[model samples]
Target: MTPSLHPTPATHLPLTINDSIVLQSMLGVGAYGSVYKATDSHTGQTYAVKCLSKTGLDSRQRAFQTHESTLHSLVSGHPNVATLHKIVEEDDCLYMVLDCGVEGDLFYTITERGGFVGNDVAIKSIFGQIASAVLHCHSKGVFHRDLKPENIIMFGQSVKLVDFGLATTEQVSSDFGCGSTFYLSPECQGGYVEMVKSYDSAANDVWSLGVILINLVFGRNPWKQACPRDETFSAYILNNDFLQTILPMSTELNEIIKSVFCLNPRKRIPLSDLAKRVQACKQFTTPEFSASFASSSNASAATATIGQSGVAGGTCFVSSAQREDKDQGDSGVDVRSRA
Candidate 1:
C-alpha cells in the first residue's frame, strides 16, 4: 500500500488552455488529477483534458508527471496509441490536450458484450492493434508498465493506448512501482517498498497483455496473480496441458499464449516476435478477423457497443465510477488497493 495522495484545492478548479479552450464539465478524477471535458472555443472541438495541480505533488509525483508528458510527446504519432495534442503549464498546474476516445474504454464494452467468446475477429483485431501499439512504444524506447483493459481507449475504428504516467524507458531496473495487482507479472509481485528486485519491464507488458487477452476471451482473469501461490496458476504451470481446456481455439494462438505467459521473463517472447507470430495465425487471418475493427450485429449487444457508442470524436470515456479505480496517473499505487 502507498501513502494517501494530498487533495487538490478547489481554487484551481476552472482552468483555461492556450487562452482558447475552457474546461467545462468534470469528466472524472483519478489518482493523478481531475479530467475535464473541454471545448475549443475556436474549433469547437471537444477533448478530454487532464489537469494536474503541481502545488500538492511531491518530488516523486512531479517526476512521474514529467515522465508521462515526455513519453507522450515521443510516442504520440502512432496510429494505435492515443495522440497528445499539446501540453501547457500555468497556475501551478499542467494541462494536457489529448485525442478523446469517443467510444469510451474497453472495460465498459467488455461488460456490455458479456464476453468476447464467439467473436474471434474482434478479439484478434483488438489484440493485434494492441500488440502493434505496444511494439511501437517499445521501438520508441518507452515501456508501458500498466497495460490493462481500462488503459485502452476505442478511438473511432481503432484503439489507442492511454495513460503513460507509469511509462518508463526501455532500460529499467528490475524493481519498480508499476502495474495493477491482477495484471502484474510473476517478477512484479513480491517487490514493493522495502524489497526491490530486478525484472524486465517489456516482459511485464507481455504478461499483462496475456491477462487482458484471456479476459476478453473468457470474461475473467485465469488467476488472481501470476505467481505459483495462486492455485489456478500453479496447476497451469504444472501442466501446460491446461491451455487445451481454457483456450481451445487455434493452435497458433495457443502457442502465442504459452510464449507470452512463460514463467521466466527471459523465456517470454519479445513484442516483435509475438507480433510476427500473431500475423502468421490462420485463424486470425480469416476475412472476419482480418479487419481491424469488429463488425456490428454479428455478435452480442455487449460486443457490438464497443465500436458503436460513439465515433471518432465526441464525449467518450468520462466516468467517475471508472476514475475511482485509477492510480492518480502513476503505476497504480495507492494507500490501499482499490479491490
Candidate 2:
C-alpha cells in the first residue's frame, strides 16, 4: 500500500508523498505557497517541489494555479525550459515536481560576473537557448508573458526558463500592464493617446526578451518602466539615437534594440530572425565601455559608466536581480481561467 502524506501546520510540509517523493528543506515561499528542495525516494533524483496551500485561496486563485500547472505540463519536454515531472494533489495543498536549477539563475550569474559586456560567446549560447525556448512555446500555442532574468534558472552551464503563472494561450489580451514594469512594451504599459483596447502578448514577449538581452550585456535595465512617464524611455521615443548616445553600444547592437523595442507590434523582429541576428552581430559595445566595465570592481561603479542611465538607485525598480521565483505573483498579473 502507498504511504499517505501528512503535513504539520507549522511548516505545512509532509515527510513523504506516496512511493517516490520525499520533501526536504524549504526553498522559498510565494504569495500562497512554498517551494521545497525534494528528492525521489526510489531513484534518488532531486527536484524543486512547489506546494500551494489551499488555506484561503479562492476559486479564481485556485484556477490560476491550475492554469499554471496545465501550461507548464504542456511545455515540459523542452531542454531550455524547466521540466515538470508530475503534480500531486492532496486534501490540504497541491505539489508540483520540477527541475531544480543548482548553480542559480541568469540574473545572479550576470550580477556575480559583474556583466557579460565583452563575452559574445556566452551571450550567443545563453540568449540563443532562451530564444529557442520561446520559439518552442510559441509553437506549442502558449505565450510566456514573463521572460525576465529572474524567471530563468541555471544548472551548471545550462539554463531553463520557469514561472508560467501568467502565461496565456491567446495572442492578444485586454489585460494592460500585465508583465514586469521594466520589460513591458509601450502598448502593454497602455497610456498612449491612441486607445489600446487590447495589445499583442506575443510582441510584448519579444520586447521583454530585448530588455533581458540588454540586461545581459549592460548589467542594468534600460528603464524602470517602458512608459512615457519614465524619462529614459521618453527620451528614447523622441530621439532614435537616444540609446546609442547614453551608452557606448555598437551600431549592430543599437539597431537590434531599436527593432526589438519598436512601438508597433507588427514591426517587431520575429524571434527566429532575432535569434540569427544575435549570433551574427559583431560586437555588443565599444572597447572603451568594455574596458571601463572590466576595470570597475563593483556592479554599481560599472553601471555608472553610462552618464544618466539610472543604475545606482534601486528606487525605480520593483524587482531586483536577486529576486526569487517564490515572489512570482507579486511581480506580474496572474489572470487565469477555470480548467
Candidate 3:
C-alpha cells in the first residue's frame, strides 16, 4: 500500500512522500524555497525535489510560484532546460521533482575548469545549447528574463537552464527592473527610467547572450553596464572596429557579436535567425567544442524504469526530452491543466 506523506510543520520539510520516495538531504535554497536531494526508495533512483512553502506567500509571491511551476512544466522536456519529473502538491507545500544536475552551475564550472581561453570548443557547444534552449522558449511565448551563468547548471559537457522565477509570458504585464545587473541589455537599462515602455524580453535575452558569449571567450565582461552612458559601452558604440582589437576573433564571430549587441532592439537578430547563424559559424564545429552531451534519452529510459507512480493518486515519470505536448490554455488555466 502507498504510505501517506507527512509534513513537518516546524522544519517545513516533507517527511516522505510514500514508501517509494525518501528525502535524503537539502540541496540548496532558492530565491523562493529550498531544494532537496531525494531518492526513490524502491529502485534507488535519485532526483532533486524543490520545495516551496505556502505558509506566508503573499499574492505576488504566490503568483510567481504558480507562474514558475507553469513555465517549468511547460518547458520540462527540452534537453537544454532542466526536466520536471513530477509535481506533488500538499496543503502546505509544493514538491517539484527535477532532473539532477550533478556537475553544478556554469559559474563554478568556468572558475574550476579554467577560463575558456584555449577551450573554444566548450564555449561553442555550451553557447549553442543555450541558444537552442532560448529559441525554444521564445517559440512557446515564454521568456526567461534572467540569463546569467549562475542560473545555468552544467552536466559535464551539457547544460540545463534553471531558475524561472523571473520568467513571463508574452501576453503578461511585465514589470521593469528584472534580471541581473551585469547582463542587462541597452533597452533593459533604458527601461528603468522609462517605466511607461516595456522592454522586449526576447531582445533583452539576446543582449545578455552576447554578454555571456563575450565572457566565455574573453574571461570577463567588456563593460559594467550596457547603456550608452557607460564609458566602455560608449566607446564600443562610437567605434565599430573596437571589438576586433579587444577580442582577436574571426570576422564571422565579430559580426555575430555585433549583431547581438546592437543597441537598438529592433536590429538584433531574432532567436530563430541567431540559432542558424551560430550553428553555421565554423567556430562552433572547431575541434575544441566538438564534445557530445550525455544522452538524455538514455537517462529518461532509466528514470522511467525506476521512478514511482501512484503517489497519492498522482502519476510520475521522468519527462521525455522529445515530448511534443503543447500548452493549450489560453489564460490562467495553465498550472492546473499541466499538474
Candidate 4:
C-alpha cells in the first residue's frame, strides 16, 4: 500500500495582506518584527511571515530595511539561502513572506537539545552546507553581518542561512553598526567612523562563523565568559581571550577556528581553504558519521512557539508538548497577512 502523505499539523494556513493572519501562535519575534507560520490561500504552500509593527519601527529599522532590500535583491534566487516569496505593506507595517523550510532555525534546535552537537559527522555536514550558502552570498557581493546559530535553519540534515535583515551590499559602505553585539566583529565595535573605511565585512562574517562553530561544539558563545558584560566593542576586542579553552577539541578543528577568527581580516582563513580543511578532517571520513549523518528521522514532537509570551517586546520559542491538546489546536495553524 502507498504511504499516506497527509500534511502535518505544522502546515501553515493561508492569509492575505492587510487582513489579519489569524494568530495561530507566535513563531518568534525579534527587534524589528514577529515571525509566524502562515499559509497562502492561493498556493497552499506554508510560509514564514515576518510582521513589523509600525509602532515599533524607528530610524534603525529604516536603515535595516534598506540594507535588507539590497541584500534580498542580490541573493534571493540561491537555494542555500531563505527564499523571499513576497514583500507586502499595510499602512506603516511591513510583512515579508519567506519560504518555510521543513525544519526550523538551528538556534531553536541547539537550544532545546543542550549545547553544541556531539556528532562530529553531523557538524561537518551542516558546516559544509552553511559554507556553501555563505560562499554564494560572498559571490554576489553581499555580506551577512550576522551569521550565527540563530540565523541558520535545519531541514533534516541540510542547513539554510536565514534572516537577511542584517545583510549589506558590497558596493555601499555600511553606516549602521548593527548585529547582535556578541557576534559583532572587533573592527565594527570601534565606531563606524573609524572602521567603515577599512571594514572587511567578509572577514567579519568569517569571525562570526568561527564563534558559531565554537558554540556548536561547546554549547555557549565562546566569547561569553564571566557573566555577560556591557563592554564596548573596542574593550571586548582588547580583552577577549578564550582561545586557550579550545584544548579539548582536535588540533585540526582548533586550528581552523583560530585561522578563521584571526584579528586581521587580510590574514584570516579564506572560505575556500576552510571548506577544504573541514572536509579533510578525520571526523568527515568516520564510518558512523558517514553512514548516519543524513538518515535521522524528524520524529521530535516539540512544536515551537515563537514571540514573547507575556512581555510586550520580548520574544521566545519553545517546543510543543508530545500530545496535542484540543485547546492548543490553533498552535500548528498558519497565520497570514490579508492581501
Best-matching candidate per lDDT: 2
Give the 10-residue window scoring lowest on summed lDDT in candidate 3: 330-339
Cand. 3 TM to true fold? 0.74
**Shift in Å, residue 117, candidate 2:** 2.3
After superposition, the stretches of candidate 1 with alpha carbons farther than 4 Å from their true spots are 1-15, 190-196, 284-339
- TM-scores, all candidates, are 0.78, 0.86, 0.74, 0.68
What is the Å distance of residue 63 in model 4 from its true position?
6.6
Clashing pairs in 3: 121-288, 121-289
Position 308, candidate 2: lDDT: 53
By lDDT, the candidates rank as: 2, 1, 3, 4
Model 1, residue pairs in steric clash:
31-328, 32-328, 112-302, 113-302, 113-303, 174-198, 174-199
lDDT of 4: 0.55
What digit string (tens of lDDT, one per residue) describes model 1 on residues 160-258? 888887788955456554776567877776532234467788888988998787667544455655655566666668876554444333556777778
Tens digit of per-residue lDDT, candidate 2, span 42-62: 999888877777767889878
173-231 per-residue lDDT for model 3 (tens digits): 35655666557776665542343366788888888888777666544455666665566
Which stretches in model 4 have alpha-carbon errors above 4 Å?
1-15, 18-24, 54-66, 114-116, 171-176, 191-197, 225-247, 283-339
Off by over 4 Å in 2: 1-14, 291-304, 307-339
Question: What is the C-alpha RMSD, rounded to one decimal, of candidate 1?
Answer: 8.5
In order, what is each prediction's RMSD in angstroms? 8.5, 6.3, 14.2, 10.9
Q: In model 2, how many backbone clashes occur?
A: 0
lDDT of 4 by residue, 107-183 (tens): 65666654234466667777778888888999998888777665776666777677776677663345445455446
* lDDT for 19 (candidate 2): 71
